[model samples]
Target: MVLFAAGALLLGAGTTSRIFALTPENREAQATGPLTAYLEGQGENGAIWLKLRNGEVLKGRFEVKVGGSFGAYGKSRGIDRPGAAYEGSGRAIQGGSPAFVDMKGPSGATVHCEVVNDDANAHGSGVCLFSNGAEYWVLY
Candidate 1:
């Protein structure tokens, strides 16, 4: 009976370790870097926190606006699904607004992006598909 109990305990411990293991998804979410730097440039609000790779942090709030030439609100392009089943690529256009951080590249330089928007919008989930290439996220 003692031997059986010991086996069961080991199995349970292994299962728990697997459950707590670091995954790519979790790493990306926890790994702060360039994203945090850009957010710091934007300054403070109450809605979001930008964490830097070097251990600095910034806080900010963002509001979403839809109008004018900026795709008429709600209408957007290039959103990827979870599990990396879909993908798209584009170039960052230059513009000025609190909601968007401009991502620019050399002439004719295009980069890939995947949607990882986890926020929920009225239409559906807000998770965006993005890559580690040249791209920016609309934080709000």
Candidate 2:
């Protein structure tokens, strides 16, 4: 009886560990980005216009239809740089709440934004982790 009980306990512990183990799918799902979060909460039809830290303006329009997506177009005219067109796409990740966004911009730049506070309106804030080893505080 003692051996049987010990075996049962070991089996239970192993099962518990397996249940809580972080699988690849779970890891991907939990790794939501800020842009994804922002676009997800945009509802069926929503829009945002925000100013970047570099004084460039970004205007995004989100459409939840057609598999939930967002597109943005903007221009940056820095001190010496001529105005250049900037465009990007934000796609929502499946089964991600508060939304995880995968965003890709011009010149192959990408970032992930997770929407922490989504009022589902014209204003929101999130943290963006860029592909170029940079992070920024985003407000829209």
Candidate 3:
């Protein structure tokens, strides 16, 4: 079996598929359909694939741009200090970046996800908004 950091897919030459568990955000969608979503790193963009419990599948692609994170702001933090990082008041607010996802699901419906990650590791909790006016809590 292949493994990554904290279940995160280390974006290598392109051999990792990050998966996310989706929870319905609205009351009407709480009862049925659209369960999980996943992403596969492929260079600058990745393929976002989602499959519902009812057997319906949706195919889409997402592009990741590293922002407000470690590597992206190394020079700004401190070039002298090798491991210098930006710290906040509470643990809930750390100096990490968020990975955004845009998946076009079934019937022209779009899914937008914002996960806490460094582009390489697609891990964290976020939300996906379906174009059909449905929202879901996404955790990867």
Candidate 4:
């Protein structure tokens, strides 16, 4: 039985997957569907603030470039960093057309990201806020 349990853990199934959640409650949140979010804006170290359907929010630093390959930022595994990180990698599903997706995070933080074009750096000058309570800003 122990061997079977360990094998299950190796496969990253529902059982072991929960062990890796950012928080205990965050683990359960993973069961929810993939988070829906947008690109918001390009930030230093690729950080982005996602505005979600719910009133909650998600802020993280990433390494995504405008013309670089796409990364699956919405995954639970991508939240290892404190404020910002480059946690996901994949093809650009939305290309340069800009897209929004339902994003999920630790502690049931549901959020979204809307793409904005900002080429500034330092003193958090590379972000733009919207009336919808969403803002895309740089981490550094």
Compare the candidates by TM-score and give the number of the best one. 3
Q: Rank the candidates by lDDT, best first.
A: 3, 2, 4, 1
Q: Is candidate 2 or 4 superior in lDDT?
A: 2
Misplaced by over 4 Å in model 4 are 1-31, 41-44, 64-140
CA-lDDT, candidates in order: 0.23, 0.27, 0.49, 0.26
- Candidate 2, residues 1-140, lDDT tens digits: the string is 00000001112212211000111122332343222222212233333232333333343333222322222211111111121111112322222113233445444555444332222222333334455555444433
Per-residue CA lDDT of model 4 for 40-71, tens digit only, reads 22222333344433545655433323443222
Q: TM-score, each model?
A: 0.25, 0.31, 0.62, 0.23
* lDDT for 104 (candidate 1): 21
Which regions of candidate 3 deviate over 4 angstroms?
1-10, 68-93, 118-121
In terms of TM-score, how similar is model 2 to the real structure? 0.31
Between prediction 1 and prediction 4, the one with superior lDDT is 4
Q: Which candidate wins on lDDT?
A: 3
Q: For model 1, how does the per-residue alpha-carbon lDDT over 65-139 read when each residue is reduced to its tens digit? A: 222222211234423312321112222222221122122233322212222222222011112222342223322
Off by over 4 Å in 2: 1-97, 120-122
Q: How well does model 4 score by local distance difference test?
A: 0.26
For residues 1-140, write the lDDT of model 3, one tens digit per residue.
11111123335565567666676769645755447666666554666777655555667655544553323222232311322211122123233354456665456656555544434334445455666666666555
Model 3 compared with the native: what TM-score?
A: 0.62
